[model samples]
Target chain A: MIGYLDFVIALALAGAMAVMLTRLCLGPSLYDRILAVNSFGTKTVLFLSVFAIMVGRADGVDIALLYALINFIATIAILKFFRYRSLDVALSQMTKRIDQVEGGQ
Target chain B: MANLDLTQYLDYALIAMLVVVGIAIIRMKNLFAIVMLTGTYSLLSAAWFVSLDAVDVAFTEAAVGAGISTVLMLGAMLLTARDCKPEGKARHIVALLVVVITGAALLYALGDMPIYGDPNSPVNAYVGMDYVAMTPNDINVPNIVTAVLASYRGFDTLGETFVVFTAGLGVALLLGLGGRKEEEN
Candidate 1:
């Protein structure tokens, strides 16, 4: 019974991933693609967890945990790169630059 | 039995998704979108690897492919044009012909391969079975994967770590080791 539920969950996640892929490919705006990619990564994490349960292996959950952490870091890095246009910029400098712009306004 | 069939279907669906993502990545003009799609592609591959019971490979793919590669590509994108220049149809046709030939050759080779999970397969019948049997007695590690990587294959893992260290050193040197900044007093 539990295995059947896991199977259904896995199938649903796969379907959702297909939809996300479609959104990614047809997306006109860059943000759409970024969101789709991040969402897909999230789904992958969930799918890995479900698959691990289905297969009766506990190792898949560990990988899923790692994936979730990496996915977040990657998303943040991408967003930061887009915002600052440079990854090497110091956070202090970024905050000061933002302050200066806000002060001028 | 029923659940096994469902998992198999999931595997096929994931593979189909991978193919579609690969085609989309090749056809896309926007560099940023392409990078994102590549991340999606990597995540899909990681999921597929998990389904195949290759949790360790899936972990590496998730970390390197989905995480590090995406950030690296985004960094590289900063130095390049937003949109890729359109290529000629002739080039596409030539590339397609090469891909078709290589794929055909691989498919032909696949026919000679042993069935998946066959205990009689050459790979499963050899040293691998020995390791599986010996791990509990010799290494006493609960997870055979960890035991094999850290103990039996320790030298190979050490070499891989050394290679990674060298790559990190090279990157640091190239970037002037400026990963962090010291605040002015």
Candidate 2:
């Protein structure tokens, strides 16, 4: 009985992923694409969890957890890189420099 | 059909999603969109791996593909143009022909391989079987994959770790540990 439920849930997630991919492909802006990518990662995490249940294994949840962590970090890194144009800069330092400039002006 | 397993439908859907993402990645010229689509491609592949019951491989794919590679590519993109230059018309035909031929060859080759999860397949029948049996008795690791990777294949894992360390060192050397020096007055 639970297996059927898992299957149904997995199928719905897959359908949502298909829609997300469509949005990703049709995006008129980079932000739209980024949003799509992040949402897709979330769906993947959920799908992995449901799939682990469907397959009657506990191993997949470990992977799903790792993916959830990495996906969030990657999205942040992408946004940060685009915003600052560099990865190594400290965010606080950048904000401080901005404040200094505003004070000087 | 009543006999059809619903999970198999999910498999087909995932496969279809993968193909569509791949085509989109190819057709798009914007580097940002392409990078994002690549992540989508990686996530889809990881999910597919889960469906195939290869959790270890799926984990690696999710980490390396969806995470590390996406960030690395974005970093690399910062040094390059935002959009790809238009290719000459002649090159497209040649590229398409090569792709079609290679794809056809791969499809033909696929028929020769054993079906997925076939117990009688050579990979599952030989050393894999030994590891499965030995893992419980010798290592007492409930997860045979962990045992085989850490114990049975210790040297391979060590080598992979070394490769990753070297890559990290190279990147640090090239890019520096700290942010690029603030522009001089």
Candidate 3:
């Protein structure tokens, strides 16, 4: 009863996952891409858990939990690293170009 | 017969919510709105699982997908920009093709699956009996889901944990010591 219904729900959500993938591929900004990927991760967790029931295996639940943790931690870390090494920071950095422009120009 | 009962009504409701959330994730221009759609997607999925009598699976999905994943996405958003750049920017044919191919292959394979809840199905014959038959001495856990996950399939769960550890290590390496703005003090 509920099993078939769950299958329908999982299927519909998978459709959403497809849309998120579009954003990940066609994102206009880095943050958009990050958000899309995070959305994808959340869906993956649900997909795995539903799969556990579809197959009657409890192991899938454990795997979903592991995946969810990984997705969250990775998103934050990547964003932080980007900020630390942003292109603006690179342009502002002291270099030979600064000396040459300051001295010659 | 049983599926056509109240369960179908519930199923229709869940499917409606799922479709709505799916559209929200894609159509929303706001980054937070998209992230939030993902959260609702998780909760709806958890509810779906619960309806299916897989409460343990529902619990995990609710906790991890609805809980931790949202926080991480928010943190990631904070670390960088918020609003997405203007739309209509990048090429995406390859990814679409891949997703389509994969979905098609899976659906084709699933067509051969045994009937739902068939009594003579191998899953019911070879597998389902153990949970009912072996609770007393073979595994001590009252909850069959816990027993199967922790003992019967213990090694597989450990492998999953290993993957989480690996990801955590990777995040630690990537972020270093950077914190939010004004935290430099």
Candidate 4:
């Protein structure tokens, strides 16, 4: 039945999450850890969807969509911060370029 | 077989994994791995909340705990050293004792709590039921959580949104991303 499928999918997601946890705990490099966290976020989104089906609350899908968007933004922010040292520096540099373009125009 | 359901089994498994992950996080010395594990922990907790049928709470936890906090912590880690300094044995022991006592007190308090998902619990019998019953008539929204959060609790949500805005503004100011840039030039 549909309920059995939901249970199976949830169990599979949980198992995958367990593996990601181990990778996170034992990751040798920072990149590995970052990758693990990103993968875990993906799994969580899928898990939330499966859980919505299990509970018969289709509205829970909205939360899953929110999670997906937030997770993408967070990962991008973390990477940008890591590369630029300070987010302010990045923002300032962009604004300086914009001002130069305006002056040229 | 008679006592256990699929959801209960899933809950127990997830909790067991969470405890292991928590211990691993504490034992690890690498700051990056710790941050990553913290995200995993948050996701697990959010999943657990979903299992408990607290969709709104789960949503908040997933967004804030797993998403925003992880990015913030990563930003902090970038500004700090990657490795944690070893603590004194005495400090460690004191911290451990404090944690144990607090955890024990919390467990003791749990005895007075209503059983999980009990229909007759005061929470379910009162305001929770009122919200569920009236939500359909008053709000006409499919998702009661959204209706309550956006309409019934509009002011509180507004305050929360402002709090997030203020925090972002503070971060921008601290990082010199605000009007200070013009002053510097």
What does DockQ give for each predicted structure? 0.50, 0.48, 0.07, 0.34
* Candidate 3 residue pairs in clash (backbone atoms < 3 Å): none
For model 3, the docking class works out as incorrect
Query: What is the fnat score of candidate 1?
Result: 0.68
lDDT of 2 by residue, A7-74 (tens): 88888988888888889999777777778888988988899898888877888898889879878867
Candidate 3: regions farther than 4 A off: A1-105, B1-4, B86-90, B159-185
Which parts of model 1 are misplaced by more than 4 Å?
A97-105, B159-185
lDDT of 4 by residue, B1-185 (tens): 32127778779878988998899988998876787788788888988888777777787677677766776787787689878999889998999899999999999999999996799999889888888999999999987778889999999988767756754553453345433345333
Fnat scores for every prediction: 0.68, 0.69, 0.04, 0.51
Report lDDT (Cα) of residue A45, candidate 1: 85
Worst 10 residues of 1 chain B by lDDT: B169-178
Per-candidate TM-scores read: 0.87, 0.85, 0.54, 0.81
Native-to-model Cα distance after best TM-score fit, residue B38 in candidate 3, in Å: 0.7
After superposing candidate 2 on the true structure, give the runs of residues whose Cα lies further than 4 Å from its correct spot: A96-105, B1-4, B162-185
A15-102, model 4: which lDDT tens digit per residue? 9988888888877767777788789889888988887888777866887897787677667665555555444553545434222211
Q: Which CAPRI level is candidate 2?
A: acceptable
Lowest lDDT 10-mer window, candidate 2 chain A? A96-105
Candidate 4 residue pairs that clash: none
